[model samples]
Target: MGGFGPLETAGPVLVWTVVLTFVFLECALIIGLFLPGDSMLITAGVVLASQVSGEVHVWALSVGTMIAAIAGNQVGYVIGQRTGHHLVARKNGKYINTRNLTRVAELLHRHGFMAVLVARWIPWVRTLCPAVAGAAGMDHRKYTIASSIGAIIWAPVLLLIGYYAGSFLENVSWLMPAVIGTLIVGLVLGTIVGVRQYRAEMARPAEDFDLDEAEQEPVADSPWRRA
Candidate 1:
């Protein structure tokens, strides 16, 4: 019932709103690093499976969330383009601090399109990769293709998992309690891990990003951006 609970009574519109909003925020422009993107997708499916007539069917949910995720990443890419590479220097943010940004940069540098495509499977990396790729001057077309593929793979799998599993577990007495308990445990563990990582990351001074290379060639001129 964290956010999706009360929506049961409110009907599918509000539920769609919540799901799509989070789908966008986590995968796209909002940089909601701490959001439970994976769990949410899975749970959304699972919940729909058990519901009598509420929430969108799994296929629709999958497609809608995929669109939201792709759109979100595209927006994030534009934000990165506008913000440029200096976004890596941003610090003191709750989650968008320098450390996380730098990590995204390194990952992008190491893998290029591969990173953007697969980042969908990783939580924090997925949140920041589009922006990082944009800031780093990855080609918009390639980023779009990669991000779209990522969204396609990411959304439906999780939603379907919850949907089909929920359908099967619908008759079980322990489903609700088990799910609630699992969510609670996951939340606590995620909090603890996030806090520890935050402290450690913040402890280090911000690293100087390579500004000279970026300034040497603008987006239009850079072959990397055209790739």
Candidate 2:
């Protein structure tokens, strides 16, 4: 899909504009990340490189993408803080998963910065991490700092890699279809795995069920012979 038709836009500036917009939207909106963020960044870079006049600048693309990414994550963090937990706990909410939230909360507690850093690289998890951090009662300032750094670093790096790859394959006739197909397959497999894990976790009893339900036995007195 990164071939001669739609990608062949009017000019470099216009192309980068669209790319930045998509990046921001994806980072902010829960459903937006699923859009072609990785592909667009790389494609934009590759397309710019191949232009005879080279009107599109790599630094511009990188900076614009980084801005969109950081801002998007910030918006997501605020939204999640404001209403995400209540929404998920609601009866009919579709976006929130209680099990995954709990697990990620535990991960955040255990791994802290590493969890946030690593989560930056993952797809769906990335969008949810900030919200999860907020909902899990983490300090807002810390979440903001970590998410801002993560978004800036993660988005540009991937875009650059894609840009180089796209440049390499600019002339190749067969590579585009193959990349799209692989992405689709990987997405499907990821969905299946996520669903299975969610289902399995939901089937387990609440961790505190036994503690909450167990009968209280009389305490044995210490043998100090006090009444």
Scored by lDDT, the top model is 1
Model 1: residues with Cα > 4 Å off, grouped in runs: 1-8, 54-56, 88-97, 177-223
Q: Itemize residue pairs with steric clashes in candidate 1.
A: 28-72, 28-73, 45-162, 45-163, 46-162, 46-163
lDDT (10s digit) by residue, model 2, range 22-41 = 77876776555345556556
Cα RMSD (Å) between model 2 and the true structure?
10.5
The list of candidate 2 runs beyond 4 A from truth reads 1-9, 53-56, 89-95, 170-227
For TM-score, the strongest prediction is: 1
Clashes of 1: 6
Query: Backbone collision count in every prediction?
Result: 6, 1
